[model samples]
Target chain A: MLVRFWGTRGSIPKAMRAEVVRSKVIAALVAADGRRFDSETAVARFVDEELEMPVAGTYGGATSCVEVDGGEGDFLVCDMGSGFREFGIDAARRMAEGHSKTFNIFMSHMHWDHIMGFPFFGPSFDPEVKIRFFGGHDDLEEALRRQQEEISFPVPFEWLKANIEFNKVVPGETVEVGGYQVSTVKQYHSHDSYGYRFEAGGKSLVYSTDSEHKDDDPESEDMFVEFFRDADLVIFDTMYSLLDAWTIKQDWGHSSNVVAVDLCSRAGAHRVAMFHHEPIHDDADIHRVHTETIRYEELIGRNSRLEVLCAYDGMEVAL
Target chain B: MELKQETRERALIVAPNGVIDHDSAPAFEEQLHKVLKSADDGALSLIIDMKDIEYMSTVGLRVLMRVSKRAREASVDIKVAGMNACMCEIFKISRFDKVMQVFDTVDAALAG
Candidate 1:
């Protein structure tokens, strides 16, 4: 199984400002110390070895779309955020190269950010392609259709040429979809989001975003730990700090990196990716949060071997 | 977890020792709530002295937060003081420093 992050930003899409890019360039040049690279390989090596991730590359601006390739058959997509547009283009190219045209998409919720890319999905206009949407909400079709209403978008849902279908997934029931056993769990959110767990070929990956973990809710935490138990990779929403999540941002439908690490460590998951980064955070701020999360994991990971990863746009993990 | 309770300057001081983690959080919560209950009866303020606390996990922090919320509801002024370097870092990284009123010392918390 392979997992790819097309977008990792939360709340909304946040493009990197020109000044931020200029600062990164200045920082990189300062680190280079006026030394000239003989080859592209040398420059790559310098970027890899000398500069940190924030100074080298961006975490990106796209919001919450992850592609989980099961290595054969139909492609499974987690969300349809703005990043889905890029994923759709690449997927269309793959289909043109004779790849599968069937798409099995798992919708976390109908939040605008999670479904905003549907209008731009290139394959949606293709008559030969088949798209299946699976979600815990019964209003999945209605939500999609409403988003494509004439007042909202120029394109109407009925005008789409693709053969689209929607299936409501019952929570706690594992259903086979796209050559994998997929299960959904109800999450705490304003409109009630659902987290999906996928298992195939003895590998497990849990996609859990836009969910809030209450500071004092032990029962809910235990349920989440069970949902994340012994997974190879858990993509989690680390969109807020503990202070914000507990104080001003309570009930905002997001979790913190500290909670992610704690839950993943408790569940004995091998690796946890911090996904759905706070939109207000710059690349440097995200890097700092990731660094702090790693340190927190070390502090709390007594007898637990959990690897912490910060999910960036275009990151791929294979299991 | 063992909590030492005392009253000083019309404020109730509850000092917790050792690690406040998953195993000890319930006890800490119970003792802290009891202190909050007592403070609501008479004390003008409540101070959690963490000078002897070696570590605090997420659960422990949650317990503190719940207690703080209860204190606020009860109209009792609650403050935290005397965290070690590691605890301070934990608060800083978790952003709990902004959530709660933290002081360098018990005297500072009392004075401020």
Candidate 2:
């Protein structure tokens, strides 16, 4: 299974501000410190090795879109956040290359940020495409349709030429789609959300975002631990600090990296990816959070083999 | 969570100690409702003294937003005071600061 992140930011989409780019450039220049590079390769090496990741790279600004390639002819996507635009264009290119134009979109919830990219998804307008949306929400169809209403959007939902289907999934029930087995669990979030687990080719991947874990709910925590057990990769929502999540952000429906580390360690997952970054947080803040989460994992001394990676747009992890 | 209420010069001061989270938000909301229920019915002003509050979450923020909206409909003024730097940052990032006035001290909230 190959997992790719199209967007990682939570709440809303944002671009790096001019000042932020300026600061990174300044930091890179300072790190260079009168050293002259003769070629672009040397500059690339300096950016990759000499400067910190936050100073050289970005987590990107797209919101909540992930693609899981299961070696199947069809496409499998999780959430259609603003990042879907890029995915759609890529799919169109693939279609032009004589590939199947079927899309299986697994929605966590119908929050605006999650579905905002659907209207702009180019494939939906292509008559050759077939799109299937799966979710646990009863009002899933209505919610999607409402967003494309004439009052809210210029295009009507009915105007889409693709063959569209809505599948209402019940919690704990596994569905075989293409070559993967997909399962979902109810999550704690405003208006409720669902976490999906995908299994294919003897490899497992879990996509769980916009869900908060409560300390008082030990049973639920244990359930989640079981839900994520022995997965190759677990993409988790780490949108706030432990201090923030536990204190003032309680019931905010988002978990912290601290909780993610503990859960993944207990679940014996191969790797945990910190995801759904806070929009207000800059790359430096995210780097700090990622570092602190790793430190917290070591502090607990649960399992030294558990891997941690911060999810960034355009990053791909294969299992 | 412990709530201490004091009526000072036509302003109702609500002081909540400890963390305001999922488990405690309901109790916090209930306490505020009780105070509002008992207050004289002309025009109301509330000053939330958060000096002793160590933490808060979006659930707690929702309670504040809900209560503030109700207060607004009733022509009441809601102000917050004594938020720690962390709490202030959360409020600012969440944009809750735009909905209510925040002050460093109770006197400042009351005066403003």
Candidate 3:
């Protein structure tokens, strides 16, 4: 199984501001100093090795949307955030190249940021495509339909040409979808979010976001550890600083990198992809958060092999 | 956990000593709501004095946010006083300072 991140930001979509990009460019130029690159390869090497990650790379601004490839017949995706638009375009390109036009979208919840991309999803307008939506909420269809009302959007949900289906899943019930075993667990959030676990090809991946971990209740903590137990990868919501999450942002339904590291370590998860980045955090801020999380993990003396990854747009992880 | 309640002027003061963490937040919340219920009909404000509070976790903060919302709706003022430097920093970062008034001392809170 392989995981591809189309979008990683949370709350709202944001584009890199011109000033932010200009700062990165200026920083790169200053680091280059008197050096002159003879070719594109040399410049690329400088950016990769000499420049800091924040200056050379980006933790994209798209919200949610991840694709899980289990080598199956249909496309399996999680969340239809703004990133879905880009993923839909790519899927359309694949369909143009003789691939099947089936998409299975597993929703974490119907928050505006998570479902905002559906109307822009290109394949939904295609007559030959089949789109299936899965979630724990029985109001899944109504929520999606309401988002496309005439007042909110130019395209009505009824006008969509694709054959669409909504599947309501109960927590802890495993379902077979495109040869992958998928399960969900209720999470603590304002609107009742869910964390999904997918197992296929001898690997397990858990996508858990928009959930807050108070770490005060032993039973709830144990349940989360069990849900994440021995998974290959755990995609977590690390949207705030530990201090913030524990203090002012309490019950705001977001966790911090420190909590993720602690939880992943306890669960014995092999790897953790820090995800659902706070929209207000800049590239430098995210890089610092990721760096601090790695350092915190090392300090805790967990499994030496446990890996930490900061999820970015277009990043692909193979399991 | 020790909780002390006092009535000062038009404000009801609740002072919690020791850690206001997950284990203690629920009890604290219950006590607070009980006091609020008794003071609901009056035009009294709510003041949380954190002079002896050693630590407060997210669970503790949730209780405050909930109370703050209710206080706003009821036109009741909520003030946090006697927070140590560390607690003050936490409040600022969480933006709780914007939602409620914070004072350096209980006297200052009462005066305000």
Winning model by lDDT: 1
Best candidate per DockQ, number?
1
Which pairs of residues collide in candidate 3?
none
lDDT of 3 by residue, A1-319 (tens): 9999999999999899999999998999999998988999999999999888899989999999999987657899999899999999998998898877888889999999899989999999899999988999988899999999999998899999999999999998999988889999999988899999999878999999999988456678779989999999999999987667766688999998867876788899999999999998999989987876676666553345568899999999999
| Each model's fraction of native contacts | 0.86, 0.00, 0.00
| Local error of candidate 1 at residue A33 (angstroms) | 1.6
Candidate 1 structure quality by residue, lDDT tens digits, A60-126: 9999899998777998999999999999999999999889999999999999999999999989999
| lDDT (Cα, tens digit) per residue for candidate 2, span A1-319 | 8999998999899898899999999999999999999999999999988899899999999999999987658999999999999888888998898877899999999898899999999999998889999999998889989999999999999999999999988889999987889999999999999999999889999999999998557689889999999999999999987656765798999998867877888899989999999999999989987876676565443345678899999999999
Note the clash tally of each candidate.
Answer: 0, 6, 0
- Candidate 1 residue-wise lDDT at B11: 89
Candidate 2 CAPRI-style tier:
incorrect
Candidate 3 CA-lDDT value? 0.86
- Tell me the alpha-carbon RMSD of every candidate: 1.6, 8.1, 6.4
Rank list by TM-score: 1, 3, 2
